[model samples]
Target: MSVAMKGLRNHITPVSKIIITSRSKNIATFGTTEALQLDFLPKEAFWYFFKTIAFGSSNPEEEPKLAAVCMEIAVLMNGSFIGAHVIGGILRSNLSGQFWYTFLEYYRYFTGWYIHLQGEHQSDMFKKRSGLTYIWSYKNWSAVTATFHLYQISSANLNDLPVIRTSELLTRDIKLEGKFDALEWRSSVPPYYSYMVHHEYGTGNNHDVITAIESISFTIDRYYRQHQGVEENLRKLHRMLLRIQAIVEEAHGRQITNQAMLLQLRMVRAVMYRGYYFLDNFRYRTVQAHAQDEVGDRSLGLSPFSQFKRFCFSTRTRKIASEVLDQKELQKMLGHLENIVSDMQEFVAFVSCYPRMSRQPYCSYLLLENCMFGRQIEQEKIINFLLEPNHPSAKGINVLPIIGPGRVGKSTLVEHVCHDERVRKYFSMIVLCSADSIGGGFLTDTGLIKHRNPTSTGQSLVIIELADDDMDDRTWTRILHNLRGEHITPVSKIILTSRSDKIRAFGTTEALHLDFLPKEAFWYFFKTIAFGSRNPEEEPKLASICMEIATLVKGSFMATHVIGGILRSNLSAQFWCRFLKCFRHYTDMHISVLGEHPSDAYTKTSGLTYIWTSRNMSVVAATYSLHQASSAQLADLSPILSNDVLTGDVEPPEKFDALEWRSSIPPYYNYISHYEILAQPPDMLPKRKRSRSLSEGLV
Candidate 1:
């Protein structure tokens, strides 16, 4: 082979090429050029090929039932071109649904028996050149009498042997007393190969075959029940959701003075988000399946057998597959949604009673992205505190403290409340004073009066944002003294925001502590914003990937939007998987080194964070000295965006400014961070220890 290839190469011109193909990798070394390894057709292409050949001159759409059966049969073929041709011919010979079902039952049994006997799928067994063994029972016989060994054969005089068709084995007349060669299938394409199996008589009962058939029937029935009327249920769910959304939108347009009604509205909105998530997830199941299959196919040059081993043995893959295949859970979710909608009839009627508040028209998702999320109750509390009237005997101003960790929407919450039409109408002026502004003499009696609205009540609402919790009552007293010199009334109020619990001492009212969103709520929020207008159901695999990403995000809104935007920009499963991998690596790296996740450090305002850049897939350690800064300071910083750095769009300097994210909504603060790229030490821990550390950190 080497000598022949060398002679052929010599005869070929510079522009001309000699192409060679082989099933074995050893043949590649015989060529002078690099070898090109071909992979199995992607699931979509293979399905199209299989169905086209299986149902020649017939429309699959017209025979939906048979087409469905053909899909299962195709899956059983396991990307084998010869298998497709052989099975396709058998199905094409008999167009009857009963005939197809019978063939499927037999095929399913054969594959299952082979797996049981070989400890691997028949596909993998064949790929390894290992003969497949399975018990065969005839329908007319009360017992199993045949044992088969299926294997591929390549010989010069293949036609000289007695050829027995695989379909003939399904009949009662076929009998084998001893081991004999029986042709299983013959390829009609290039490199036409033949598959033959050896058969021998055996003594066994038919119980095992009957049991396998029973199990298969049960699974098929369950699947049927799960998918039956799924389309109609989804349509009904969509319609009910629209109705519920109409009510929710109407409620949002109104100023509901009733606290109970407001709480009910929140419940309705939560259910709405979940229903939509599941609805899209179910509708796009097929798309997600194809995307996931593609991800598996592009496993960095792994062969079909390697991919099969990974699929069967990878714990994570198996778990995800099990979750994705749980049709019962999906059906249950549908019923739950239907029940919630049915229960909302009265709630929907009462939502219209609240007086309307004038607002700009916007889509729900757009409004969510540009406005506050998962903070409706907190926003209402702040607004109520500002709008409440003070007692006649009350001394000094009424103060309410809002405290939370960094980037917990402390400033954004206050901004949204101050912009409320009701609050604006109630207070004569709303002044926002940061800790720096107060210390720098930005707030004064003259400034207060100057900033106050002319056409309004004499009461002023002052919102003070403290940088930390160390501020004492004296500072609050001084601020009040400066405000009291102006046109402050008994109804005047002070709202203090800080990240420390010590600041709560300055407030006369109970401090409202903000926390990260619960897992379910965050998933809903992340899914909504990350998926944007694209229906998540259409890319279930991507949605699932997003779900994992959301968990890693640790409920940080900044991470959600930043990472979500990256994912949303590229809908490709491969890109999303790459991002997921890099994110997980960095997250695990941070935990292994620092005993905490980067998000945990981010919430605490400063720490070491490991970020992965796609540039050569290197890990960079960025020690954050500052978590945020004013939009004014953004002018002095580098033009590099944090996302651009993470995505490897641009290289980062040793020490430079990177804009984390800028809020589009209230406060409109530009979050900037200062980072120095510290050298990452070589991994010294054993592989087992590193994995253990990652698992512990995740927990």
Candidate 2:
């Protein structure tokens, strides 16, 4: 640790002084300051504890030691937490999660910190001493707070926690005692708000709790909850600033930066993330309450509300700090905040587009493209597969499962069909919902409770499924549970889409297994996106472009989309000739666009994200160009995927991959979390599991 940090640490630790209680009744079980400290409390024990966890490893034979260390750390943290509870202390820093994570039981696996950054502080010692120690920092305070809140927020359905405002010390069973069951629940929960992004609010107080609850509630109630999740996280951040503003005012009151003021700030920061979870448990069904939603059926005991609260808090924090705050001290904070919001938005939007990716998924995806549907034999085959002749539920008109790999356009096809005017008018209420899978970002707007059943009595309901399939069976089971009505209350039309053939295999009814778009249609879609509105008649060269597209696509929708996006975006007759030449070169290691290299073109242009703003999408859009590739492809295309790609308020790059990207799906790492549906290829699903996560190891 640097001398400054060491000095800071020493000053931050509270030293207990004797404060004899006025009377016995008030003394109670815990003492004043001394009572606040845990057994064998060491002022700087946390730093050592973290260093051991981050830098040390354990052997199986040493399991007891690891367990002991974990328990000790937990004890120390619980003490700190209780200590804060008594005095209502502030957090140690703007970054809040580091402390709370010890008890949350999420990071018992592997987690560490890195700090080799420069802030224009060029001194050699600054790099050496200041950079030697790495920590989780204040960025992930929201996620930590969320994990902690899991115990509280999930108690909503409990016979306990009768009211939102409870001052009495809360006590309940929040432990995950078994070998991996507890961790499994923790694993399934979203860590969208990680330790890297969130900074701290000094005081762990009632206001932040309220803000955290509001954020989580906003996320839970809103469809496409991930976006709201981010928004709430941003709010927590703004609240964090509010805490800082208060602290600065307090310090300014004294007109000094003395030891007293510094200690006060650390104390305030400590408490901010302390009971930060109090509000996380506010809006949703508590773990104690029966989920009554889809997830409730599968993992019955754990709560995801904690992570949800954290995510909501982190998202809100970064947003308002950039959008509204103009404090001079926060000048650079403004820039960083804006970047965080942009990245997070891109991250959120990308995750939502995963569902509804099948050829017949647009209806399920919620895109009403006015498409036409056909294919009888495939549909029948799906029905047969869904309900085998021997299965008990095989007697009636059964629901069939539609299955494919991730990013395959399953949801898109379903969405397209559902949105068809015929289908739209066919069902009294066509509800397209998502079952957001583990580790994925928020995709569709539909939750298990609110969005699934929209049709009234005597009306037909078409239930289009998305991400909810992973951990939810209630929504689907509800379909069966609701079907035995005596009066035929409502005609239920159900379509299920999932990457898991296991889940799809269980669905029985009319099923259509999506394959890649046919060659002719691929050509049409590719040419349409590539050559749009520009007359093939006016530019006779379109014939050659069309032939080139057909050859490259080769009956693959993905290939067509990727090539078409490129061709249409670079639509000048001259650009087409060069584009064709460039395509040939990629096959032959050739470089095409002259006067500017391809890399330079990526740099000089507004970047692909802005291609949507271009009036003439043909020869100038990104979405139209690569219609079938996953957003993961775009994330890989970053640096080139600049800010303009987000809001699309700017002009596109010259020779851009043109196609107005109406789809809100941004690229995300996890395929399942998309709001729409996965349009994965036939063999891709198994391979993803076989392969290592590309982003996890290095990044």
Candidate 3:
């Protein structure tokens, strides 16, 4: 089909339309620009179909009770018209309410049972038992072989999609494997579209870290609600939380693809989310106990209005305090979490830099391309500034700081401007070096370069490049003073590219903040890269998917380029759909790659917050480490591990132990505290005569 589409694209008329339909969305993209989607019938349409068949075209008003039941059954079917048709036939055979009600319950039980069975890996033979055996107890259903017909209908409606129970459907058809008949049978299960890209590879154990934090927060919240003052244990817990937060903040930027790191993260998240799950019950109980106490106080010598005043005032003025459940269950979980965190911190402190790959050196010269988006305006502004030397400076040297978020094409914009014919004619030498390459010896090197070039006194261009958003004002100022002294020429120029605004304070005469691609430009550039010359109108489905991808990235050119590269590898719509499902994880992975670039060296510096920014994403996270560890860089964490940073604190890591806490909670616990808020009447209470303090108004 793809080959056919390729041929058609070459030979077909310019305005001709071609349509192809396939079960696989990937197959639908063959030689197609647009894909038209057909949705399932809406409830109203399904209801009309049900009424005509179930009632033999009779008016539903005559049998309103049956009509109502059918309506409910339709809703339960989840827009499956085929289910309604088969079940409607059964109703036609027996018009009694009991029969219909029994079948409805039977259907629910069958589905739930099937789902439950699929969750386990049972033998194939055990699954093929006749559907009639379950329904044989019911009176008329057995006589008509109703269960057999129901099974047929159910199997026909079921598709291979894992949306509901693919395992059950697959198991039932195990005998027919490899046959053409089996292939047809397999199509019965519908395609599941809501699958998310597995994050195990990308995030590693970050989910565990986050879940643990949530559990701690839940416990802390509960503790404060119960107690009015800070306890020693509570303060200790808070300090531990702050430390964990610091580690997570630092680690969030680093790749967590290591197995050991992932294990630590998983254990921590499990212990925390699990601990919170059990401890949460105590929080509700504590709130309830307090509510009961408040209720008992209402019986004191106070008016109804006064009571209302007290309740409102106390609720408003309530402060969170340090009070935790003394239950061994909670203590056990908290202890486990503390140990996990301790180990995690130790791991973080000891982790070393990823071994650098020996790649070919990058070319000093810029290769400007016409396809580059959002560079024209920036290039022009930078070139105009460089060509005209009217700005005020100490020693005929001007520093223009180009500041913006990461991956905003600051380097590319400046590169294109440097490569311009006019820029080359105006400036003597264009030297681009990473900020890390600059040190105490930079002045001597620049002095040597200046002395060697004694023939020309024209302006020299020095490009100071920084990748990380961490160029400090003091560093920049020192560099500028040293830079001015090294040059023999009266007028020298410096173009500083950094993501931090700290450069602005030192010696920046002018700043150009590169903005992201505007909405129209972003879409145009994205579509061009994703589809190339293919008209999006011809393949609407692919176009739709591209739009979704655009939304996820929020107009990042680098992201757009990365997504385009991934898409170019495979043209299948299914591949594209799957990519879309896991697009966020992929996006993060790419941002991490960008952060590792030599130009963004700000990540290794101390006290600097590293932000992974796209046109739309704001991932500005503050990086921190163990307080004892002098260096904050993840690359230089070896010192921390050898120094016992984890044990240097108050206590040991593994004081608490519990096997039961490791076990997952019961599924039914999902619905324990599901509550609904009811609207109160305006006249429920009289207005208060005076505003009252929380303690003064209490009964």
Best-fitting candidate, measured by lDDT? 1
Best candidate, TM-score? 1
Candidate 2 ranges with C-alpha deviation above 4 Å = 1-397, 420-428, 434-491, 535-540, 553-566, 587-660, 664-699
CA lDDT for candidate 3? 0.43
Which tens-of-lDDT digit does each residue in 1-699 have in candidate 1?
757656666543543556877788997876778898999898889999999989999877545457767988898888887667767877887898766766665565456444433455555534544343543533332124355566766766566887677555544456544566776677776667788867665433233444444444555455456545655676877888787778777777677767788788878888877776666555543443345557863211112333223222233222233333445666687678778878887887787676777664442446367767778767777777777777454474788989898878888888777778788777777777655454423334323331345467767777777766567668766666665553434337888888888888777788999988877678778987888888765667788677768889998888887788887788878888767756765665556556677777657667666656643456655677655566667776655787888788988888887777888787787877777876653354223234333333321
Question: For candidate 2, lDDT tens digit of each residue in 103-189?
Answer: 232221111101012111111211121222111112233211211111222422332322321111111222211111111011114
The true-versus-predicted C-alpha distance at residue 43 of model 2, in Å, is: 75
Model 1, stretches more than 4 Å misplaced? Answer: 1-215, 218-222, 230-235, 277-290, 296-336, 361-367, 434-451, 473-491, 627-632, 680-699
Clashing pairs in 1: 280-537, 284-537
Q: How should the candidates be ordered by TM-score, best one leading?
A: 1, 3, 2
Model 1 lDDT vs. the true structure? 0.66
Per-residue lDDT of candidate 3, residues 1-699 (tens digit): 557656767654653777677656775546447676776678889778776767775555444445656666665565554444445655676777655655554343333332232332112212343233111112221111112111232433334423222222212222111111111122223652221111011222222212322434655455565454333444455456556545543443343445466455545433443443333333332342233234342111111332223221132122221122143444564676688675775667644343322211222112111234445435555665676655564456677888887656676677656655556667656666666555555443532232224344465677777756677757776666656664433337777877787776644466877766655456545766677556554554455556556666676654455465455545556555545534433233323333333223222223222222222222222222212111233234322221121112122121111010010111101101111111221232121111111112221
Q: Using alpha carbons, what is the TM-score of model 3?
A: 0.32
Worst 10 residues of 2 by lDDT: 178-187
